[model samples]
Target: MTNRTFMTVEEVAAELDVSKSYAYKIVKQLNEELKKLGYLTVAGRVNTNYFRKKVCYSEV
Candidate 1:
């Protein structure tokens, strides 16, 4: 298992510079994708490493 943990919608909003509603939408979308892949998801939060990869693609 990885050390990566989950992030709240507030953290997602700050990280994406988006509104809370938008953050919820993003989380919901990610959660749906995870569900399709047979992974369990939590409400109002997302996996940190996955979130980073989704939004921080420019990092080295």
Candidate 2:
């Protein structure tokens, strides 16, 4: 029930077609790799928001 774009571990796993256990592992690893600022976690949870390039091209 949060308005954040970030998804939970189980949600991400479903999106990636993986098991919850694996999802947990992946999220943990991502956390280590990201080491991002404003990292919000509750009671040891795996959370992440994938990043992407935003290309802006104007038609001439």
TM-score for every candidate vs. truth?
0.83, 0.53
56, model 2: CA deviation in Å?
Answer: 18
Compose the digit string of candidate 2's lDDT tens values, residues 1-60: 353555577765776688988877766766655466556544224443331111122221
Candidates in order have lDDT scores of 0.85, 0.53
Candidate 2 Cα outliers beyond 4 Å, as residue runs: 1-3, 36-48, 51-60
Q: Mark the 10 consecutive residues where model 2 has the least summed lDDT.
A: 51-60
Candidate 1 similarity to native, TM-score: 0.83
Worst 10 residues of 1 by lDDT: 51-60
> Best-fitting candidate, measured by lDDT?
1
